[model samples]
Target: MKRIIYYLTALVFACIHFVSCSDDEVEGTQALSVASFYPTIVMEGTEVTITGTAMGSVKEVVFPGGIAVSNVTCIDDRTLAVTAPAGVSEAESALVLRSENDEVASRQTIRKANPAFLSYQFADKEGAMTGSSMTINGKDLLLVEDVVFTLGDDVVSVNALEMTRKSNTAIKLVVPKDAPIGEGVQMAMSFKNNTSMTLPAIDIQKGSGGGSWVQKEVPVYSGEPVDAGSWSGSVQLAATLFADAKVDDVIRVYISDCGSNPQGSLKNGSTWVGLTDDLEYFNIGDDAANGYYERAITEEMLSQMQESGLIVAGQNYVIQKVSLFTAVWVEGGDEETTDPITPETIMLNDFEDHDGHNSSWDASWTDAEATEFPVDDNGNVYLRLAKPLDGWAINCNHQDIGTVANIENYVIKFDIKIEAGVTGASEAAMQFVLADNWLWVGAGLFPETTDGKWMTVSRNISDLSAELVGDLAIGKASNGLYGGVIPAGVCIDNLRLDPKK
Candidate 1:
């Protein structure tokens, strides 16, 4: 009797399974339950497979933007396929599946792919360390407001200011300074309306690796590699990299390290050719300062050099390394505010050593005559600017900070003494220049140094507009206006940025 009952039950279950598979239907009003789905996120018009119990009855798939895809197909009694429709918002929302007499929505959210991050491709295909650069390639990446990395409760973010938006499909970002590290480090991109999605894990390697970016090199032509130390070859710089570089930027093509290596001849991208027909344009001149040939890189050259970079093939010159050095500026304004300054800082440059902690007053723009390092009556050494002559009156000196610079709460201190008889002693001002913005820290902002006496001047940069600076200068760069009031004989000493003590 028991065997007869078991046989009857097995026959009934087999019949129900066959009926459901053949007709793509389930018994009346069966509660649909989702087991799982592959690729919870996808690009529009991409197909997705959903698996669940009683899913054969699904007749349509409704996307977040209300596009009802009625052409859904059932693979079997427990599987269905639907292609995502276009014109849907790229955010997390319910994927509703509709059947003849039932509606089942996924318990987990589904979203359309956006900023579609393809991979963590570094320039060299390796660097994934702090301060090194990595590129995120995808569609509509401009929608990403901030890129975030998190490990447990610790979180670090790199914003748009720190990233270079190469194009609609690519963005380059240097790893943030305080980024969290370890296995299972989660990465996510923040979009508008607080929408975010979990992405593949990123490995933030330990130890020091930022050197790849700080003193990094660019690409060289491939073919016959120039004699390792030979200078008779070509160098190429990507357009997007130096397109925003300012005039007077110096490119040194040398047979040394800390720059790009000379490969073939001066050529565009891959084509072997010069940017212009001028013979002097290809003439790679020698630099006495750094023992390399230097060329003034201007916006015009950049336009032509976008693809091919500069060529150093003049007379079989065996140059090996190439470096592009940019000049940083300091700007100030006439506006002054009254606040008690709590002085603190780190020594940047004394104008005596030309070296400080990660900062230096590079003498590329001047010589010992115009900028003198003289000992005072008390044997105190100081830097002085000689009066402007018939030549360009560039009294202002530009200081170069290393790859890392002191930021907010870190104030720049300058000890200054302006000759009382100078033209604009009463209105004497200092300017800080970065990129295109100019900030002028006028008289009342610091101290009255025009009395012909050295006075310590300090400015808290935390409230300033700029976050990091490449260089700094004593005065403004106005055709010749600054040379008038800031006469030669102005003395400066003890220049540095330090934490407020």
Candidate 2:
């Protein structure tokens, strides 16, 4: 009986040992989750925050290759307010959470930001001008006092008689007129706390120094309507040559000079060639620093802008140079007499070279016949359609010659004024054609078929069938003189030949 009792007691002791060991193992195990911020949070930054958590105890918080956390205050049992001191490198930093017994959890991310200034943009009720004085408007400018503008260490100081607080984001100041032009143009605005920003380019003219527009008759070109006038390539017709805003506020057409690249800078689109396959929307060329539109097309393209074609087979083409108020169609060339396309043929070949083939339109004179394409004092001309059109199409043989490889897209940029009459119809507002090797390939694009609105249109170049790269054209479809019948008016302006990049 004594021996049996001893065996049972030993077994019980073994069970208790196992249980205690299991409990110790659980306590020693650790887990942690650390917060991550894509752009490292600066000392005083307040945009976004990500946190990392550990299942076990946390000991020290270390920043990878950066300044260690100085004053860490425990907000609660799980949160800590970590202070990132200044003077750390502007590189990525890893945050590590170490627990007791050497267990640790880490997160790799950008270093916490410092209070370094980035830039300042000065503008006011009137507008941002060169002579206008403005100050800092962002956060963490508390220690700012005297601001210094610099370029690559060149310092220029502006006297601030008053730093009026227009709001949390703006300050008013008085700038010296004698400030240097080129060097002082781009200033690095530094504050008393060492936090500074680079100022943006400012405009000098606050008001229109030029005179108002005056009615003056302009000579019409031989081919153009009596009301239409010719604008030579040499003239900087900022104040004189203008289409009716009602017909088209934004110009989608461009004129190029001889020996110039047909391709212009394209904004809001792709860059590389032969690789891009999608052409969702069109964009315009990059605008210059000045608000006025400059020469965007090559000289060669300009020479071909108004090419006349004789109808090879069909009825005589009624070619009239009337100012299009709204939507209208223009053909690039007459159809092939030998190859009459039928419904059995693919849609790509249906409209090939159909320039001014079938379209009709209306024209209105913004200023009476007293002046041809009215000119403002600054040589700026303003013409717009009295009403808007529902839809329109284009077919031009102008393609970007600089494009060499697999042509992926043909982009066009213009403004659409819906309120004037451009109404967004169903799936028929805008459309485009795509081709490969000059053979019928496909047709995929959205055509603008709305009334009373101004909008930008960009059709995919790959959508055209039968040709992938080479010559291209744009136009509309109608059943009138050349498949164009205008019920509503649509203005077109600022035409551009935008390359993907």
Candidate 3:
């Protein structure tokens, strides 16, 4: 019995010793240590390798800002790898390595990457002229400290006041007037600590013209229209030729309004009287060019001006005189030229002869409540538009008056006024359309005047002859109403087609 008991005790002791050895083998005995890490600076999502002992027991790696790295793998007991978490802060942060039972930290701190260049574009993405507003779209724009434009050796530094940071993705700037004008201009941005890659080339258009040229003012009239018999019969108007004038060079003749008297001294306030057929450039050596051009002044021309408010029949008078100016196009000379005016004034409509009939006037509306016909009070007639819908109200008239045949020689003028408490007032526009040809010209009225006062709007249709060959209709261009934010009521009067002056 004693022998059996001693043997059992020995067996139990042996079993206990074997179990203790197995448990020791399962728990790691190596101490965690970090010798070093590669890439002291790291961008988000970059894989980092740590060379140290007992790395296989690492549970997780923590970066600054509570960012925990995922997909950690232990290559061996001495090397560990993990994908860096997306950095949330711009500052540098210490790295923390956590094991199942211990933790180790690195002395070095990793920082978020600096801004990187991707691409850029103008606000319109098409291009911009100098002095025009432009927008740049790119990444990390918030860190941009300064933007520089480069064209060969010439550089333009944008004024600090000119740049506006709209967002992290967009910056607004005005194309500086001195910015180099050419294709493939380089743009670059500098950050607090780094500079971005230069953007692909961009195009900037030429700005307004700047230069000098010669100007000569030829006398339009030395005497009165009546003295020249221009009021009743054909009159001869002439100007002396310049010595250096070329045969092919252009000579534009203009008439001046010698308010009240023939000998009124030419001054800044002197008005140039424009007549029909005046804007046409006459070759310096052309018809009867014998140092002069003759125009027939008849009763018809005088009557037309009297009817239109251009000249008061008895109170105001037009001299049978014109001023001639000459210009020649040189390879690198100024390209800007002014058109001459000829006086062939005609009154298409004064709203005085409505006669209670639509009488050559038609009212059209879109999303409008009502259209008021021409109302006359003491010879002053006006057309009123009320409750215009999203689209504007237009009062157009078509006449077989042969005006459209030579539309280039004429201009349309009218008085427009916005009524108080009107909606979509700023969105109101004026348009002249030729229905037969479907050609139309329109402009916004709000830009010139914002108050409710009456304002005269004039447009030269000289270049629109091809489009104005059909019956003419004048009204508001169809602009989508701003959800009824603009005034809805307006007044229009004195719609007329007068010879360009």
Candidate 4:
């Protein structure tokens, strides 16, 4: 019995050696092979078959984890159909085939899910009207089957055209033609995966702030002479200064008149207009006890005066402090012009402040202050330069500040700040600019002198141009001679462009 056992063991060893040799000869190459894998493929309910070659007769094949395999049909000895497990991952799987001798295996890629319709649509503001072509930005949009879009929730009738997936992230679609223009209506988009996305509806108002930016309205009357009708009763009064203005332009306000003798008044009992806040009550026919005097108006006083009827139009007014005038004045010196009514008394502050400097001050080595564009409780702006600087030359050939237009009786106004206690003012004169056209070479005050106080400076644009519409460039030296810097450090502010009456 021992001899028989030894012989049987030797036979078993020989069989094993034969199998090993065969495997070594066919290293790395499976007798049967799976061609390729359908990566990223989605499976709904699709059948898959394995294809390869087998050396011996093939029997039944099994899938991974002992799942029942069906629809098995051998082509010859190798290629056959083995049922793929439904709802399994579309990835690598082991296939065991029972051959005539033993079982062999090769990996087959199984696709449990096939690419299907998700959802897609334009991402527009909710309540957006129809014909809105909004960008449909999303994911899983690659290789999309179809995209359905509609105005409302009902998807029965899709008004949207098929979306051509530009990439995995974006698609383009339009709001349906029949979309409503009111609220509560939404835009729905469906992707090939049967997934849907909706955008909130927006009201179809004309200007419902439908922009992506904040709105900013420029301040109109940044600084105009305090008017008699200063009290509009509302904190936000509708100002007339900036109804028509250009950017980077300065504006000014000057007090025109104080009560003249024989205090003028209509039966309305309105007091005369004054540059100052101090008021005097007098009998109808008598000169008020105090002679023509000076009275100052603090910001608080101005508010109080606004509340009283003393600030009505055409009232005889006086200057509390030496005051300035309105910014939109005529050309040339505000030299006392006849008060259209008096025709004798010169209206010192008649012209609006848009006018350029009233005079010029050359460094004759002799000059004075409060002469050209005078300032009281304020400083005057002077647009002077040493020489030609880069990107700073006076230009009036283009639109905006650089172009020349038909300007008639227009004025230019600007403000300046002087350091407190400064004594001497600068020789930097404001120009009645007329670039490319006949330049108004400091027609008014040259090197305009001031009291070294923060104030406003204005010039009549009409003095520089005959055209009713003309552009004004402020700072420029026509002579090309370099001038020394004016000791008075002045800051320019709020340049303006106003129409002249």
Candidate 5:
């Protein structure tokens, strides 16, 4: 995440500007005319009103670059109101109002206001945690072409993946951990005119978000695939399966060929005729695809499972392999982008927040939920995609800042929770990519990680050309035939770009 901010080009203000409209009344039987919109300085995306005779006939508003916009609204016969667009070239220019037969021009040179800094707020805390969001408010911020954090001698601009222009008045970015903790840390905004302004220097504080991670995989059972003899019959895993596990540990039961609905209970010493199936009972979703069930170990659950492990009984299901994950949290902190030794990064989407970047895809078919993307009860949203199926492609639009044509030292990071029970439960190819171009990172580039837990996969992308790559895509990477691969409920989240560690 260090030196990660020097690659942005500029932010696009999204429109051609300097058009004006007003609501002043026009007298009857008057020639088609318009009054010069006052306060010639206008902000992008703000309403600009112009009062004119025959405004009811105005069909279009012409902005700078001769960009004609027909989305103007007629407030009344004598008044027209249209949102000001982002002006690219002519700072001060004449705006044209076009009707069916004639054109009316603004009597004044309406100019788009430069981005003016107002104030700034760190995350909802006294000091900003690394990976926490900070917002800067200003006027005409839509015209802010570039934003950088000046930490000491470094002028850092995050790639398009992290920064977001929320509205004309606000832009938000995630704080990086690479800065030395102290004062004189400044945020600067640059505009098209080659001018820039800086906010007041503030104290840079370190946050304790991410930390060192250590993982352990606990296998329950493994064998050739076998079908359940009956819908109500039970398959009992030995108590030793969880003998080495502890309370507060998270375990994922990997059941091979989990046909559809499955149910189970924590038994005491392999009792088939159960005493009572109460709180010990569990249900697996009707999943013809996924083969794993996740659970956090508790005092009572651990005590119950210690006797006979688990008894799973369900209809039409196959049992080939079974395993449990013993995930431990050794909390040093968010070690990836938030550790002091790591480089700075622009956070794309944690899915905890519905980031605008997620919607930047040309066509979003990420998951097939009933109506919308699934947000879990824990507030985690997911890109539930299949392997080698590269449909989860995010555009390389760096918050209107610039492309991600970056140093070879930069890496892309994302969190993937693999359901290893689902036959071919492994990540295929995740790439710093552009469609079927096969131009960037290759297949199996992820770190050696086990399934059933969220593993942060960081892949170096030095192998690709430094051209303006347009997107970052993920797919199964196997084209011809998916022998036994079915990745239905695989989850992806917290994607971003940062300098490689």
Candidate 6:
């Protein structure tokens, strides 16, 4: 009976040992399987919790871009934590996990995070103004799909055509005029195939203000005419205002032929009739004072009037009553300040009209040939210089400045673009000459290498004395002489004289 009891005990112990060994072998051979990961889409350095079976022995976690994840920790048999790696390419990639003897991977890709919001501002100013260009700077900006602005009840969406992708770090766009004005205006940017984030509120100021018009009529002519060799005319027209005028408020001068008995009322139908359709309005700019305005009746203005049949050249006409009209901004309205009108450019020749020749510019050549031609089907014109035997000269006469006794307050400016890959010349030079008694000369040399870009050349003649008027001449020179064989050509435009501001 004792022997049988001992044998039974030994058998029971063996069974217990066998069961323990089977359990250990099953645990050691368990196949790794990933169920899912929390927050699958994460930014760089974001901690992720991966839940699955057989994750206790996780030795490595590989993120997108084949980058090894850092700060990995295996919590237990079913949970693991890891920090997403940085420098991942912009795409969805598989998340890989490795153990001592086996590896497991999630079927779902780990997507790269959306672009992070930083800041934005106008390109030229500290704050964005209506119609101003704005730039947004941030990290991973290339992922951005669209940008929108919230203005009161209105939602302004930036058009793709208006937005310029400057680079991966910057985007440029124009601020819509209807953008809400006040503090805490919200802006949001969205990314392609990803979530969007809202930036902090921005302050928007009142971009425009209101004003009233006060008009005063003055004489027709300001000074006597002087002979400018080519043309002569008396400059005139000055008006006054009672109110403090804003920069955008313009003083309009209306004229009528004699015997019209025109009333100068702003609303009278007869007054509108008197201001004929041919010569309807003359916009005069504001002077230094808010109440002062002036419009010099230049020779060009006279020519325009004559062409419009409002007046006859070399014919005397009676002076009718002159009326002044001013358009003022209204408060709390949609009216915006008009862009300040640039002063009238004398001797302006953009080559857009008259076959690349203006009334004031006369083409003269010495050792080169020039032709006025349009660059494209758009009718954009330019003066093309080609096949230069030596060099060329073009003369422009500014009657208004030449006629003035003191011609010391003008600037001559023009644009030049040399063709790329121009060869056969050691150097090319440009020479400017003011050829009468008040002689002035200036020259600019082109570098041996050029990128075929347009450059503006300007010379101020403020200090030169004006005893007599002469022609303004421009020419190209090579090796101290006016002539050379040009393999590639050049384009010239926007030749004009501006009053020194």
Local distance difference test values of all predictions, in order: 0.48, 0.29, 0.44, 0.32, 0.50, 0.44
C-alpha lDDT (0 to 100) for residue 227 of candidate 4: 29
Give the deviation of candidate 6 from the true structure as CA RMSD.
Answer: 33.2
Candidate 2 lands at a TM-score of 0.24
Q: Tens-digit lDDT track for model 3 on 1-501?
A: 000000000000111111111112222767777777755545565567776667766777887677876457654455567766675456777778787678888877765655555545443345766655566666555545567888999898763333532335666655666888898888877653344556667788875533212222333333454321223222233212324332222232222232332221111111223334431222222211111233333233333323331211111223333333322221212221212112223334433321122322445444434546544322235556555544434433432222222345466655566665555555544345433333234335443333555555666765545544322332222211122222446666544455553
Model 1: runs farther than 4 Å from truth?
1-114, 122-127, 191-197, 212-501
- Can you write out model 6's per-residue Cα lDDT over 1-501, one digit (the tens) per residue? 000000000000111111111122224656777877856666665668776766655668888788875346654455567766677656787788876677777987877666666677664355866555567878766556677888678677664333533345667765666777777788888654445678777776645532211111222221332211211211223212213222222222222121222211111122222123333322212111111222333333333332331221111112222222222323332222111112334434443222122422444345324544335322234565665434544444322222221234466565555677766433444544443332344233333433464454556665434432222322111101132343346555555555454
Candidate 1 versus truth, CA RMSD in Å, comes to 24.9
| Candidate 3: regions farther than 4 A off | 1-361, 365-369, 374-377, 390-392, 396-399, 403-405, 421-423, 435-443, 446-450, 463-486
TM-scores, in order shown?
0.31, 0.24, 0.26, 0.22, 0.34, 0.31
* Alpha-carbon lDDT of model 5: 0.50
Candidate 1 backbone clash number: 36
Ranking by TM-score: 5, 1, 6, 3, 2, 4
Task: lDDT for model 1, please.
Answer: 0.48
Each candidate's number of clashing pairs is 36, 126, 23, 83, 29, 4
Ranking by lDDT: 5, 1, 3, 6, 4, 2
Which candidate has the top score in TM-score? 5
Per-residue CA lDDT of candidate 5, range 1-501, in tens? 111122232212111222333223333455667865543555556567666667766778887667677888664455567776766334777888887667877767766676667888775477655545677877766555566777767666653334532346677656655644667777677654456677777676776762332334444554454465445554677777778676545554444444445554434546553324453455554322233444556667777677766765554555544445443333434422222112145344333211123322322334233112455432335555444344443333322223332234466566656555643344545444422233445446443334455666665555455542323232212111111122455555545557653
Q: Flag regions of model 2 displaced more than 4 Å.
A: 1-119, 125-392, 396-405, 409-415, 418-424, 427-430, 433-453, 462-487, 491-497
- lDDT tens string, model 4, 1-501? 000000000000111111212222222444544433222232333334444554223456555445544335442222344435544544546656665456756554333433332443433445243444344455544434444433355432232222211344555533444434455545444434355555444343222222111011222223434323222211122223223322211221122343343232211112334424233322211212211222223343344333432222223432221221222212222211211111011111111221222222322112323113323222332333232222212222111222222234344444444444443334433233333334343323322443333244555655645553422232222311112233434333333333332
lDDT of 1 by residue, 205-246 (tens): 643534221111222322332442344444445555555454
Query: What TM-score should be assigned to candidate 5?
Result: 0.34
Error of 5 at 52 (Å): 21
lDDT of 2 at 383: 27
**Better candidate by lDDT, 3 or 6:** 3
For model 2, where is the 10-residue window of minimal lDDT? 1-10
